[model samples]
Target: MMRNLMRIEIYDTTLRDGTQAENFNISVDDKLRIAQELDTLGVDFIEGGWPGSNPVTIEFFNRIGEIDLKHSKIVAFGSTRHIKNRPEEDANLQALLAAKTPAIIIFGKSWDIHATDALNISLEENLQIIEDSLAYLRPHVEHLFYDAEHFFDGFKNNEEYALKTVASAIAGGAERIVLCDTNGGTLPHEIPPIIKRVKEFVAGLSETVGLGIHPHNDSDSAVANALMAASSGVEQIQGTMNGFGERCGNANLTSIIPALVFKMGFDCGVKEHISRLYGCSRLVTELANLPHNHYQPYVGKSAFAHKGGIHVSAVKRNPLTYEHIAPELVGNSRRILLSDQAGRANILFKAKEWGIHIRPDDPILPAIIKELKELENLGYQYEAAEASFELIMRKLLGLRRNYFSFQGFRVTDNKYRMDKPPLTEATIRLSVGGVEVHTAAGGDGPVNALDSAIRKALIRFYPILEEMELVDFKVRVLSGEYGTEAKVRVLIESRDGEESWGTVGVSVNIIEASWQALIDSITYKLMKEEKK
Candidate 1:
């Protein structure tokens, strides 16, 4: 598709609407960090929060006000004036003014159901609320945007009343009249025509106002709906970072911005900073301590991951054969995933990417492939355990270090009474630089005990191991057919002060699997230090 010449304004409401998500939470400091990131990404506007809603929100506006954003205009969000109060007297309107932002977005009911059933107000009163609320704030702020909440549903139900609400906002001086999919159930096919009708309706009134789209992801079509709106000539697109919001989410700007620029050919403010999208997406989820969706469309971990042999070979020859857009265009890199499904092509690509020199005819290539396939047959997965895969590569390439040799290890768990917690202990004997070391440690569990004992045994030779800490441990039963005797795969994430890596192990015995993963974790850490 050809790129559209028209520019679209990007507005992020992550601070306000994003916080409505159940699992997502951030501090005032976090909010400031995110705002700076959004500005760096070249978003047109950032809705800081409603100042009068809470103490944290007010503090957010005050603290963020001190930052000199490079491009984004900070916007404060709130609702229209109360039905019973004048615009000047409304607390929400007063809070929007208190935020002291250059732009403010206020939403009012457009759905007749929300007006009558939710707000218990007449349709006429709602229109007055929309008109007066915007008119009062129009002169106070540099830019005033009005959001018609539940606009799509309202238009479908009562076309006249919905058009009237938008007209009233335009009459009262809303620079941009945003149509919102508040219920988030509107389909993509339903958007363009409605926007066209809206444009025609405004044309008949002999008035023109900026058009905007704010969609939620309840039906999993927010991205599609947003694109439809843009194609229909909307100037502004409102969404949250990583689609964070109350229910499903606000439209995912992370996905939308790139799509608009690359796929749909729409010019957006974020076009220059498009390469930072992946890092920006991760930053938000990281701050919220939420697991990033690995399969998310644009900014996911596996967005460009290749597993099948045919795909790997084809992608190596021509990435366009498998990928829609270049991964680097969005700050993401292609991943040659190592697993049972991987082919020789996958290995070659991974070897080159990881800076491991290898020839297509190298004898070790076949050996490594055989070993990986054998391991996978035994229920080991190397995709998420890159450290383990790296170790295998080093071993096959003769780059491995013999930091320590394990002699033996034993772990015991004792629980004599129901009232008493189990006591776990581990003993390890190993040789470092030909020096035999014996260590014993106690922990909350057997894995922890073994980890402590092994670290105690090796800390003498590789003192740098002291800087390494285990961050996460995950165990999965590879097969449930055998139930208690099923093979288990263990992945251990380890990190030093600077870097992190994951190691994998598989065994029928859980303790053995954990032990294997732990050993690889330490080995990778030591190897990295030695190389430096």
Candidate 2:
């Protein structure tokens, strides 16, 4: 496969659809930060949002113009006229023009179902609507593109009508006609011929129009469909950086761009900054406050990870036999996971990562991993959280730290006066490394009581534990089958004095799980402090 010789436009719409995800929200400052990053990533276009639809976006472009993007052209996305007014006079058009960007991409319905039902307009009127919209935009900017949304389904129902829509956009002075799989239901096999037909359709028109694609993932083939379009001669691809959009989302440019350049040997989007791919994916997810999807293809945490014995053995011998590509090519590291099925190689590999040396067949390693796996089966999952996993491994390896000497402590949760609010009472019997033996008490809930008790038990030896604070605590219901007694798991993230660690615990009792995590948090804090 030949790499694309020409510099292809890298358009990113992460800020628009990426934030639409549930539990995902980023402020305008965050969006602009992302836009600035896109500029760093060498994106040619950054589709901000529909200014007419929301005030946040309206305020976004207002300040976005102030930031100097070295390689990015600001683009605003909008839809066709609102059915009643002429496109030229539409308020949406006024909003588009107010953006003051070099390019404007507008979507108009192409699916027969949408044309009649959603728009409540006739088939011919929809085409005319598209024409009016583009005609309205064409003179406003030299770079105008039309998105023929749901083009695949539209083509399937009325091939000529769909092709005619693209033809009409060309006639309306759209420099590019992007055929969109709006519903995201198109399959990989169905894309080639459809894209081919559209390519031939444009070629016949003898217009210097660029062919483009935008696909959704209702069928999990958005990436494949987009690639199929590219293979069939589409020059431009519009997608969100992390496959973000309504419903199942859009093509994942994070995965597609790298796969296109490294695996398929094509050029698009910051081809040389390959190492930033995973970092970019993570940053966007972080900004959105969305937990990174572990199984997301190519750039996800599990993309090059291996666990099963057979797979690990094979991969250790020949990575190409299993891995699609070297992880480092896309700025991701390969990981080997340990579970019941994990082999000695898996444990040894992980140990090596943290600069701990251990033989694969060491007398104690297999036993340690087996015990760890059993603990995991009992409700502890460390695979997704590495810091806590490493802590467990270190403990099993007899690497222990004694930063402070603790006496004894008692914890009580209020079940009377504050029965609903979870009040806690705790007391500690004390000592430190034989220093200022001072003991004061404080607490909020059961976990807090335990934490305060432990801190009081140790402040005499090491005073830094007082500086440690629990930043976040997450509780996971492991199963519902246990009925009222279902096993629960907890992950505690603690930070203090410029250091952080994650601790995990599991038990049938929810409070017990949190208590176990509290113990680990205190222990980890002590160990790290002592080592320092």
Candidate 3:
């Protein structure tokens, strides 16, 4: 006997609904790039945007029309015919046609209140709006999807009217009736029974009309609701990448797609390409200039990271003992965090993974372990400074070069007037290959000045250092009791075009901490080049 695999459609609205998120906006080029990425990820549909909303949306539709998307159909989004206008005369409806996409998705009011108050039209007139809008686009497009706005609340308040709204859409040849939780407050447990009732009601309307779900994340139940909806036999699941949308956000497809395929035994079409999930999620967040939610499930940096001693040891011995699934299954790698809680197992695993061969009984292992603990006690966190950790490991293994020796450096800050910003300057003296070098430079701040001076002094011996740049710097106070005199830990992130690395230093002096971190950053860069 064969199992029946549920075939689910993934309709992504990252380009449309995602941009509605506060502090989350993408350019036209960003939209095109995301469309191509979704196509490569095997999404069934990509809702471009509301073509008639603004110039940005119109430009997205115009530009995307020129590209040939591989797997996903470009969907132009819009609203139903206005109460005061005909379908052809409505600007929104005409813009959907102008988009020239293979599919069109238009939303209309389903709730009696939204129709009577929001659209300021009679409830009966709203039904005509849904029917006429879908009917007008049905003949022109290969697929037509009608979104029932505020669908769940509509069903709860006026079940008969919501059913009638979906019936009108089906009557006008809508291929799919998408139930939208526009406010995103619907509970997960409420989904299954509600969908069951809708299925029973729609059965009498049309046998071929499919059901889809569009949920927001206001109450953080959007993902749960979407999964429940899919399990309850909704043919289509609509969401945005990384859950970026209005209010809290839309359903996070990064989380949903994996759950549906790996856990629930559903066929979401992207099972083969699901390994790209992490990269896809990060790319969207990166393009939007938003910090990736490190705590996000499935794709977050901390998702599979083990921090406790017992957990790390168990994960090292048998990953499945502590992990729900192999991190690689979602294109993410398992990370055993090294900190105060780290045991010998953590060091052993990290050494082997970094390609530094070390036996369980290696003499240097004990020394490295002792040094790591001492450093961590001083508030040096290696978890975020893996490059520094790796460099220390390599040094213990005798595989690291001296690179260059730091001598001394001085930084000065001066401000002549209250309105004037402080001017920072630094002078560095260092030895490279037994040659003495001295350099001076100015920067916006003390750290930047120190970094410039160091780079100037070392660039002659190691010309490759010119390619490296400090991308991020963060400072944290380990002990706040001292206030201005508190011990600080500095973590510096550097990128050398091909890859990025993090290094750390801790001290009571902020400048000294920064200088230590900067030195380690350069040393790690040299070490990586040597290994390569």
> In lDDT terms, which candidate is top?
1
Better of 1 and 3 by lDDT: 1
In order, candidate lDDTs are 0.91, 0.79, 0.90
Q: State how far residue 372 of model 1 sits from its true place (Å).
A: 1.2
Which regions in candidate 3 have their CA more than 4 angstroms from the true location? 1-4, 397-399
List runs of model 1 lying over 4 Å from the truth. Answer: 206-208, 415-421
Query: lDDT of candidate 3 vs native?
Result: 0.90
For model 3, which pairs clash?
Answer: none
lDDT of 1 by residue, 230-288 (tens): 98999999999989999899899988898899988888889998999999999999999
What is the TM-score of each predicted model, taking all chains together? 0.97, 0.88, 0.97
Candidate 2 residue-wise lDDT at 222: 88
RMSD of each: 1.6, 3.2, 1.7
The full ranking of all candidates by lDDT, starting with the best, is 1, 3, 2
